[model samples]
Target: MDSEPPAAGIDVSKPHPARRYDYWLGGKNNFPADRASADVVAEAFPTIRLAALENRSFLRRAVDYLAEAGVRQFLDIGTGLPTAGNVHEIAQSIAPESRVVYVDNDPIVLLHARELLDSSPEGATAYLDADVRDPADILRKLDESRMLDLDRPVALMLVAIMHFITDDASPYELVRTLCDALPSGSYLVMSHATSDHMSAEELADTNAANQRSGVPFRLRTTEEFARFFTGLDLVSPGVGSVMAWRPGEWRPHPRPEAVAMLGAVARIP
Candidate 1:
């Protein structure tokens, strides 16, 4: 894949979660450091690559479902390196007038934002350099951009990125802050990594590997993952594995547990 010059202050010496994730997704936008860190995690949990692919699949399905449901606006936070079936692409394909805003703090992702995420003629797509932990900043930037109307319903997507936000960061409150800002008809589409399906030995090994890679991975339980949907009306198929979230004929992974990612979609009633 072609790339522009590294943005100033972008330290490629250390592995970043987004780049490591790109490596796992079989993308060529990763560096040696990212490959090494991804390798460490793969050694512990061989299914990590599958999990990443499945996570992308879940994102596409969620976007398609929301678009079909008549939610024309989307706010995708912590959107990593651009891949196929992006939020705007899927939504605009179904609804030409759909609008989407992609947010991420990574300099590399920001540098390639325009090149990878192209908008439809009738719709709009904007990229924001912001952190997920700071919802106020994100909301302010979105409002300033005028890409989305807060008064109308929007689908807030948080897929496979929440695990990086540890307990001390008050992730639940952060999520609530963003969701609370949207209208009652808004939706929350999320997918989180979990250890609930792993054996004790596997969980310990995976945690140790992630720790060694210098990336924080706080795997949650199924029940803990369900807490993210609190105060929202969960759609059918409640919280379940990523592979089982309205799976289509496009199978990305062989087994559900191999993905180890839980997903759910809910509406703000």
Candidate 2:
């Protein structure tokens, strides 16, 4: 853990999803506005906190699996505010030579990433202030910066962020472009929010509240979310709830409430 440094572009007025997510995960790097909005969302959908925790756990498992499968590079986009067991930490723990490039549109997340997302001596980490909708810009910046070798296998992580991109944003095309750019052995790890686990009234309430909060969360169906990985080969267990995807020894078991997000890992072959 790093020191409690000041955050950059920490807007206290408008509510940002990354900051609100940080607040939900029990981190202190969020503004009052973020906390208020997160509280409202959580109140509407009480299992939101569980969803965040499960999503984080899924990230750890996915990175570990990728690193063990010889993936030494990682590109984590829409990375929310830093918390325990981040991408670099998980990858480097399995293989110290892992390299990670984190991208996020949130300036506050970029600031925290620079301060807290430290890398091992044998590895490297960099932050890009960019949006997920601009895959070309991300690839260009990555090339110009020479942070990670594109020819090598890299894990593309888009955990719990796609719901923020509505159909109008062309999220599928963005994901396809990035996946197409990667080599055969590269991986795509994703966890997306869905209404599959919630009742009609619950889903309606969640949608209405999100509209009011300005987060624009678009919950997808299991099949709809799977479409993002069009040509990729899904890993073992295929597309399923985050809690059920390769969950090792974690006690108490995963209930439907905590596993609201669908998780999947696919290879570009």
Candidate 3:
């Protein structure tokens, strides 16, 4: 890809979800193993690549909206391998004083963060090597970094990552814990894959293929995805297909529902 070797301790032998996603986005950071796995998924559902692009576009629009609303700090959990229009870039471009903290357990992502996620002089950016399931650890890392002010309003981004967490892990509870830790005015930006539109056979085939690829995929319903924002005020055009929320001509997906991803932005009151 970039001529840079895989970061130390990175397992290149197995296909990682982040790398597979990068492959779907037409990025060159993925290996043959990831491409092979992605090929299987593409064959099963030809729209997966489109779904990835739609989710990314949703991320950009959501961040832009948040920035316009005067939210200057961001806590992006499950921040996968960095791609275009990252949180810091979008936020800082709008307000140079914006501060962003990215969290992910992948060493390779951390290795590349310094190079790709640079911040403006007036703003700051930091990365946390932690998992989404461990809210306390994430908070502790944020506390240690002091990169963001907890008392101030921060946008907690859970985009395209929560689906990886199975129900047994108490994904809902985990999200509640993270949202609870934020201030009253903080916002929650989330996007998740769903089985609501997929047929039983399609779900079965996709799950089986994902299992073989080593990436845990759990497709939640729209209601289940909405539970993460319980007791919060949803932004306009709430909880719909990712491409339908504030759709712009930037990256148009004619049939967003076909992408099978639901997204929304809400504020914790």
Candidate 4:
């Protein structure tokens, strides 16, 4: 983690989803406000840290699967604070020529963008300090990166980020805009916080905690989450719990209800 002070535009007093997620992942780059929000949510959903870890594991396997599938270009949106086993690392490990463009709006993530910039000599990496709501701007920045080719089969990764976008924001449309720009063979890999696995009491407590947390969050149902993959060719085991999405056979699988997070990968036809 960078030892520097917070970026000028960052509001440390207000909790951001990225920082709250980092706290859950046991990363040190978080503020007191983030920890407070995370703890409040944890009180309702005791396995949130486990869910975070599971989601991250899902990301690693997704990237590995894509890389092995010959998808060398990646557009990772809502990229949180860079940690071990990032998109580029996993992809490039399988194919050194992989190219990645990571997008995130967090000021702290911008400050630490250098970690994402380190790329294999045969590949390239670029970080964009942009919001997911602005799909045009994100595509423009990807063009500027000069690494990812829209005509190629790019993997659009939205891991554990869409819950921050409220329903009125048209989250599905945002996804469509990005996918529409990609070629036929492109893929969309996403995991979102879901209420489908929660007990009634737990759901109530989680909703209350999120309302009080100051950061807007929407826990979608499996049906709602599945809407994001509409008209796309869903990879096998489509729209299931993140904990079991193509998890290798080496270890026993955890029950999906334990994480309460949904994940899926779909190819744009």
Candidate 5:
């Protein structure tokens, strides 16, 4: 990805969650530091690679569902490095006029996303250099930029991104704040990394490696993850392993390996 003006407060030396995630997904947007950490985690547990791929599939299916549901606007927080299929592309394909605003603190993601991830003329795609911890900043930028219409129904795509947040940060409240901003019929889609489906040894190795890399993993119980959607109405199938929730003919056989990731899509009341 081509370099651009750096977004403030970006640290390249320490591995970031987005960059590490890019590494796990077989993307080159990550640095060697991230790859080293991802390699260690992958070695400790082989499913890590497949989990990333499955997470992508889950994202696609969720976005498609929202698009088909008549939601035309999207706000994708914790936007990672741009990959093959992105939220804007997927949603806009279903509805050409879909407007999407992707927010991320990573300068690398901001730089690459702006330059290469072009959007349809009728629709709109923009990037915000904001962190998920501060929903106010995100809302302020979105309002000032006018990239998304807060008055209309929107799809809030938070897939595989909230695990980076710890309890002190009040991830549940943050999600509520963002979801509350949308009008009724809006959607909140998320995929969280957890140890619910992993063996004790695998969880230990994965958590240890992540902690060593300075990004600790907190694998929440399904109930804990479900709490993020407290005020929303869960779609059918509720929260499940990404593979089990609307798998959609992607695999010939289903393997019940405990996926560290749990996914769900819900509608805001």
Candidate 6:
């Protein structure tokens, strides 16, 4: 794992969700602080790593589904480290003309933005250094770049990132603001962390770990998680474990309780 060199405004002494997630996914782009924080959560919830991996798989499946359904543009917010099977890669594989814009506020992600810029010859990909909480700026940049057209349908990828936005941050409205910018046929694919699948003891341990996790995290219940899709039309088998959502031929996905992340896809009518 190559440690990240210090960049302006980035403190390696504290853990960040993207780096923590990278550690969970067996990636080499993380620091000791991230590893320590991740270990704390893993100690409390043994399936934390599985949940990260399964959430990633859900992203791939959702991209596959949207590509086959004829969506050619993707606006992926909270874009973490670029790994294999990224949004444009999956979409372009099926439809070579897909265009994707990846957004993230983390300086480290911006440093590696080049990894995500490798677009297919027929498609286009761009990385934006912005925060999801500021939907206005994101849209402004998108409009300026013309990388994606708001007049057309796009798949909004919010996978595993919402949980980091605490309730005080108005997470639901933040999501709605983004969804509202898209055309009617656009889709929102999301996966959020939840305590619904945990035992009482497990919940306590995780809650404790979260206090020192170096970020604001809210593990909502199934009902709470569903609120983000309030005005949208949910796809079939909506709001269940990511591991269980359209597992396809991989029928016997690991137990939902073990993968404690709720995944769903909703179409804007």
Q: How should the candidates be ordered by TM-score, best one leading?
A: 6, 4, 1, 3, 2, 5
In lDDT terms, how accurate is model 1?
Answer: 0.89
Top lDDT hit: 4
Instruction: Report RMSD (Å) for each prediction in the order shown.
Output: 1.7, 2.3, 1.7, 1.6, 2.6, 1.3
Candidate 4 pairs with clashing backbones: none
Deviation of model 5 at 189, angstroms: 0.2
Which segments of model 6 are wrong by more than 4 Å? 2-4, 7-9
TM-score of 5: 0.92
Model 4 TM-score relative to the real fold: 0.96
Residue 166 Cα positional deviation in candidate 1, in Å, after optimal superposition: 0.8
User: Among all windows of ten consecutive residues in candidate 6, which has the lowest summed lDDT?
Assistant: 1-10
Q: What is the lDDT, from 0 to 100, of the residue 90 in candidate 5?
A: 93
For model 3, the superposed segments whose C-alpha errors exceed 4 Å read 1-4, 249-252
Estimate the TM-score of every prediction: 0.95, 0.94, 0.95, 0.96, 0.92, 0.96
Stretches of model 5 off by over 4 angstroms after superposition: 1-10, 115-117, 199-201
Q: Candidate 5 — what's its lDDT?
A: 0.82
Residue pairs with clashing backbones, model 6: none
lDDT-superior candidate, 2 or 5? 2
lDDT of 5 at 134: 97
Clashing pairs in 1: none
**Candidate 2: C-alpha lDDT:** 0.86
lDDT of 5 by residue, 1-269 (tens): 52333456666677778888888777767776777777777776677778888889889999888888898998999888888789888998999898988989887887688643488888988888899999989888989998877788989989888888888888899998998888898999999887676678867877787777677567787889999989789998998887777777655634646356789999998
**What is the model-wide C-alpha lDDT for candidate 6?**
0.90
